[model samples]
Structure formats: structure tokens, C-alpha cells
Target: DAVDQARNFQEMLKFDGAVLTKLDTDAKGGAGLSIAHATGQPIVLCGVGQEYDDLMQFDPDWLLEQLFE
Candidate 1:
């Protein structure tokens, strides 16, 4: 549901990139892949925690490794 909502927003706004939040809580991160695929946009950043400094740049290879882990 959230992924679809995000995809719609991305499509409507034509945003440059996606910022996936709450990554620290999403252990599997299946939704992240779905959103990325559906949006057809690069995930430029990820919010790992509530703190501002917890955000990190999204790397495709790194994310793939994490997903498999």
C-alpha cells in the first residue's frame, strides 16, 4: 500500500529520486525493492533511523547485499 502510494506520488511529481525511510525497522526491506521497481527511479537516500544523521546514501550493490542477508 505504501509503496504504491509512493509510486503514485513519484509519478505525479516527477521527483528526481526516492528517499526510503524507516529502513532500520524494515529488516527484510521487500517494500523498498517494490517501490524502486514500480517507481523506476533511483533511491538516492535511505532513512535508517529517526535522527537526521542516520540517513545514508542508497547504493544498489549495497542494498542488494543487505536484502540477501
Candidate 2:
């Protein structure tokens, strides 16, 4: 459903990239990967907390660490 919605939004907006929010939650954020694969656009940013400063550039290494650790 998220992939489908992302595809639809991509068609309408033609966004260059995505900003994934709520990374501090229990969610492993596999959908971010799915949406990126579906839209062919990278996730440029991620919100790790509820503050503005928590927004950070997307880092593949960090995601890998989180996934493996």
C-alpha cells in the first residue's frame, strides 16, 4: 500500500527524493527502501526524533548498522 501510494505521488509530483520520518520508532523502516525502489529516488533525509535538529542526511551505513545490530 505504501509503495502504491508512493508510486501515485511520484506520478503526480515527480519528487526528486524522499524524507523518511519517525526513524526513532520501533519500525525498522523497510518501507523507506521499498518506496525508494518503487520510485527510483533516494531517501535524502531521515527524522530520528521529534526535534528539528533530529533531521539528518540519509546514510546507508547507519541504516546497515541499525539493520544488522
Candidate 3:
């Protein structure tokens, strides 16, 4: 569904990258990665909490650690 949504958005917008949210949850966050891959766009930012202040630059190392740990 995320991939589908990503594709739909891509069709509708002229954006450069994605802002993935909900990284603080139990979700593995793979959908974000998948969307990036599927759309050929980088993840420019990520949300680690419920606040706007929690938004941060995308970090591949952190995602790798989350996946492997």
C-alpha cells in the first residue's frame, strides 16, 4: 500500500524526495526504503517521534542498525 501510494504521489507531484514518518514505532520502516527504491527517490527526512521537532535528516546507518539489530 505504501508503494502504491508512493507511485500515486509521484504521478501527481513533482517532488524531489520523500519524508518518511513513524520510524519510532515497532514497524521495521521497510516501506520507506521500498518507496525510495520503487520511485528512485531518496528519503530526505524521517520522523522519529510525533512532533515536528522529531523530524531529522535521513540516515542510512541508523536504518541499517535498526534492520540488523
Q: Which candidate number has the best lDDT?
A: 2
Global lDDT scores for all candidate models? 0.83, 0.92, 0.89
lDDT per residue for candidate 3 within 3-69, as digits (tens), equals: 9999889989957999988888845788898999989999999999999999999999898888888
Per-prediction RMSD in angstroms?
A: 1.5, 1.0, 1.2
Instruction: Kindly provide the TM-score of model 3 when superposed on the true structure, using C-alpha atoms.
Output: 0.89
Give me the runs in candidate 2 sitting further than 4 Å from their true place: none
TM-score list, all predictions:
0.81, 0.93, 0.89
lDDT of 2 by residue, 1-69 (tens): 989999999999999999999988835779999999999999999999999999999998999888887
> Residue-pair clashes per candidate, as listed?
0, 0, 0
Q: What's the C-alpha lDDT at position 45 in model 2?
A: 97
TM-score of 2: 0.93
Clashing pairs in 3: none
lDDT ranking, high to low? 2, 3, 1
| lDDT tens readout by residue for model 1, 1-69 | 978797789878988877889988996677887887888877889988899998999877877787788
Q: Highest TM-score among the candidates is held by which one?
A: 2
lDDT of 2 at 27: 51
